[model samples]
Target: MRECDPRIVLGLHRSRYERRILTSALDLGVDAIDTSFNYHGFSAHTALATAGSDLLPRFKISTKVGFFPTAGQAEHSLDPDRLREAVERSIRDLGRAPDLVFLHNPERSLTGSSAAAQDRLGMACAAVERAAAEGLCGGWGISSWDPRPLPRLVDGTLPRPDAVMVRAGLLAGIDVLEASEALAARWDLNPSQLWGMSPFGGSATQPLWGKLDPRVFIQSPHDGLSAVQATFRVAYWLPRVGRISVGTDSPTHLGELVDALRYEANLDNLSTYRRLLCEQRDRQPL
Candidate 1:
């Protein structure tokens, strides 16, 4: 894979500030934009369509398939026909084919027997492959909320991803960092091929920087950096993380993140912080 600048992928969730956030991200030189077919009941893609016509060629675009949000709840089904419809709808809604299309969250679709789960996954993967071949998408991947299927992917039991998005962060409480490292090694994949989402654990509810203990930063070499900056550095500095996706509606907040990326983290200090975070997690009760 060709190496590029460390990427900041803007995540477009269901927010009223979609246009503003997308515009700000483009101005700040974000390498990619991630959205879903069902985000804001498909309004997210429409927003991108309006703003991204001139900008789409400048960045990689990724979206998810297999789920559609409704008034009451999301309709989830990974039947091949549904998957194809979803991808086609996304392409139409976004006004361009996605560079990468992902299976929204296959784990949720898995139930009952392991054999049944495998069959479902195979069908989904096949649908994604067909989409890629048909020019609906450049490639296919998985955005897994659950890591259980990752090992199968790594070991060749499941389909390999052109890109994999998983939750990872500076906090040791997040297990995907380790899993990502191992999977990358097994597949000989570059960091760019492994996109790390939620660098600050769960950006939606509790921002990681706010939850971090103040004492963790004490005795650190990167002392001048704020907790948020330090957190971004740690995630950015990870060897196997090619891109970090952050979601925020404020242009000022986006600018702050862009500025933070300019500073490099001290390796030794980063290691120590990881150790401290692990210890903190251990101290918590199960």
Candidate 2:
């Protein structure tokens, strides 16, 4: 799966290209198409909704929140009213409701004291409930880059959605896979339900950029090629992880990405790890 911003087309002027991309993407035969609540001034959303309709019989649509920078400020609060407004706007923007509406940072709702946490949890739950009521999403879920509160949420202490989208990959070392496995076993959830992100992190640029330094979350010494392979391999085997979405902001990377996925599908664990290690080791100066 891939998460792309239709707005990356610049403005309404380049809409023709965006439209073509959307049309092409619909027929790309991918298993899913993901849109974001903050994608391309709502036009992309609308375009995707329409394009998705054409491929509805073949693909799943996953939409998310949690990076809406309003006036250059990052917004992470899961306020019910805010979330409802977002959904409504997204529906209007996309011209239809998505198959799934994921609360971008449900964990953000727990950043305060107990009372504040409760309030945030309530708001998040309300958001899901409202989405369900509106028939906006097939099911609701939470997307958390942070795992601090995930175990609790999935353990049933917190509100549970039909799924949980997480950030899992090599940058997290083995813990990435371990945490996911633990969650599945603990909650008895399927393996494919886990959604992974940032498999390469910085490993998307150069020899020392997107490389396999799993210990560095914010930096990568590997290239995007290595990152792509590593991520796809883990997600493929991570049991309940239904989809693996990579956040590649540039269109230039799309072609290489598609090729990588094609090659990735045929790779085994040993091959994947060897490639990651080779990239990492290569990054080390002789």
Candidate 3:
């Protein structure tokens, strides 16, 4: 399978100005766009569809399946029939096949036992493969919230993944932070095949630094870099992190991120920031 552009991925979550954000990101040379069937009542995919065919070919498109959004409560199911229907709906909604389709938070769909989860995952994988074979998608993967099952997936104990998306960032407070790094090294996968979600530590609404401990802040200022830039830099500079997904409706915020991607963090400052994160992680209760 071909790798996504290594620089940045524009995350299209539920937000205002969804179309504008996507267009601006493409204009700024974002390598890919990430969205799911449930984002913004499925308007996220519709926005891209409305962008016309010409613009669609410019960037790689990725969307997730298995989760359905509704008025009262969100729905989660990985039934093969449901998955097939989702894939078809996604293709129709986007007006084109996605470059990649992920099993959106498959962990949540688990019944009870590990064996049950594995069986469900296997069925989902088969469904995804059928989509790929039918040209509805070029490839498929797991947008995993949990990392425990990844080693099995990557090692061929489960279905092979074309890519792996996980919540990863510089902040120690985020779940799966260390596990993501460890998995990247241990898995038989290229950095380009590893997609880092929430490089800013969380969604745009709830940022990682919102409740961060003051001591975790960089004691020394990183020259010409904002705290946000510094934080993004840590994930961007990691050798094993291929694509970092950032979602924003503000063009100015998007521009700042684009600029930040160009500025390499000073190695000394980066080292200190990493050390602080490690210390914070050590202090956490197991």
- Give the best candidate by TM-score: 1
Model 1, CA-based lDDT: 0.71
Q: Best candidate per lDDT, number?
A: 1
Question: In candidate 2, residue 192 scores what lDDT?
Answer: 54
Candidate 3 C-alpha error for residue 3, in Å: 17
User: How many steric overlaps does candidate 2 have?
Assistant: 19
Against the true structure, candidate 3 has what lDDT?
A: 0.71
* TM-scores, one per candidate: 0.82, 0.66, 0.81
The list of candidate 1 runs beyond 4 A from truth reads 1-6, 172-174, 204-224, 237-239, 269-286
True lDDT of residue 69, candidate 3: 67
Q: Write the per-residue lDDT of candidate 2 for residues 140-249, one digit (tens) a residue.
A: 77666665555544445455567666665445444445555665555566655666655444445556444454222212323454454444444444333655566443
| Model 2, C-alpha of 70: deviation from truth (Å) | 4.2
Off by over 4 Å in 3: 1-5, 51-54, 69-71, 149-155, 172-175, 182-187, 203-222, 237-239, 265-286
Kindly give the number of clashing pairs for every candidate: 1, 19, 0
> Per-residue alpha-carbon lDDT of model 3 for 102-186, expressed as tens digits?
9888877775776777777788888997888889899998787776554443334555668878876664233365566666655
Ranking by TM-score: 1, 3, 2
Error of 1 at 137 (Å): 1.0
Off by over 4 Å in 2: 1-17, 40-59, 66-72, 114-119, 174-178, 183-186, 209-231, 238-240, 248-286
